[model samples]
Target: MKILVAGATGKTGIRLVKRLAAGGHTPVALVRKSSDTSSLPDQTQLRVGDLADLPAGVCDGCDVVIFAAGSGGDTGADMTDKIDRDGAMALIDQAAESGVARFVMLSSVGADDPDSKSDLAHYLQAKHDADEYLKASGLTYAIVRPVSLTDDDGTGDVILGRDVDPHAKAARGDVARVLADAVSSDDWGGKTRLMQTA
Candidate 1:
């Protein structure tokens, strides 16, 4: 399988790419011209394109599309909407049109509802909107909403369900493994799971 990863250069995304490669699947890293690709594996495939301005055929020949991109904390809310909401929706649309087999979304835990009281309300709203869009896009999809992310090594064990602890934290490597599993297996299809390290 050839999987297209939208945030392949980021912490968790990089881990996902490596996981896919080790599993004997081709991972296509979607990156902008300005992105630093030094962290990616030497033989990893690259597709130059920006989420803010996606190019045509970005999803072509891809079996699955994983949206792991984020606008980052340094940027303002506007950029969050641009990349997380609008950008993700655009990619979902393209993936659906391109006959991609599945779309696995990397969403946050609070995205089920954007709380005005939370500092991350806007960001959560963006993810909520994107998640909704993917659900309605007529594509086989998996939405993994993980709690706070950490840099710890993966334990290969996770707690997944709707009632997971809200304050729990997930290791980036574990999240990457779950996303990779979703791409290679049907067990995660049409499911929306909240994840945390067990």
Candidate 2:
């Protein structure tokens, strides 16, 4: 299967691309013109496109689309909306139109209720809107809402559910494995799970 990864240059996304390649699946990195592709594996395919303004046929010939993009903590709310919400929604629309099999989202723990008080409320709200849009888009989807992410190595063990500890942290490598598994297997279809390091 050809899996299109929207954030293929990020910490987690890069790991996912590697995992998919190891699993014998083609990993298509959806990148921008200025993205650094040096770290990607040799066999990883590239598709130049921006989530902010996706071109037609960006998702063409892909079996699965995984959205792992983010606006980062340094950016303002406007940038957050542009990437987290609008950009994700646009990709979801494109994936559906292109007949992609499933859409996997890497969301935050607070996205279920974005109105909750927090410094990241605005960002969560953006994620929440995009999540809701994916759910109602009539496409097969899987939403993995991980807790705080860390740079630690993957343990290959995780705790997943709707009621995970909010204070727990998730390793970026572990999250990447989960996302890769979601696309390579059939178990995660139509389900949303909150995950943390076990």
Candidate 3:
């Protein structure tokens, strides 16, 4: 399968690309011209563009799309809305336009409610709006909302669903693995799951 990974050079995104590669799938890294992609594999196919305005046919021939991009902590709220919300919606639109088979989004644990008072309320709201757009976009989709992230290696034991412990944290690798698994599997489709380490 040829999978396009938006923000494929970011922390968790890089891990997702690796996991997809390990699973015998071709992971296309969607990167910007200024992005330092040294971490990506040498043979990883590159699509040079920003999520905000991807060129036509960027997702052509791709089987799945994973949106793992985020405006970094160094950025402000506007960037969050631009990239996380608007950019994500644009990707969902492109996925539908390109006729991709599946779309998986790497959302956050608190993205279920736009009005929720999560610490990163704005970010969560943007994600919530994007997730809703995906759900109604007439495509098979999976929204994997992981809890606070950590640098620990994946344990491969995750607790998933709405009633999960909100205080838990998931390793970046673990979240990446789950997002990759969700891409090719139908079990996670049409569902929004909050995943955390058990």
Clash pairs detected, candidate 2: none
Ranking of all predicted structures according to TM-score, beginning with the best and ending with the worst = 1, 2, 3
Candidate 3's residue-wise lDDT over 1-198, tens digit each?
A: 999999899889888888888888999998999998899876689998887777788888899999999988777888998899999999999989999999999998878875555568888899999999999999999999998899776888888996678888999989988998898776887888999987
**For each candidate, what is the lDDT?**
0.94, 0.93, 0.89
Off by over 4 Å in 3: none
State the RMSD for candidate 3.
Answer: 1.2
Q: TM-score, each model?
A: 0.98, 0.97, 0.96
User: Which tens-of-lDDT digit does each residue in 1-198 have in candidate 2?
Assistant: 999999999999999899999999998999999999999999999999988888999999999999999998899999999999999999999999999999999999989987667889999999999999999999999999999999987799998995579899999999998998888467799988999988
The parts of candidate 1 lying over 4 Å away from their true place are none
What TM-score would you give candidate 2 relative to the actual structure? 0.97
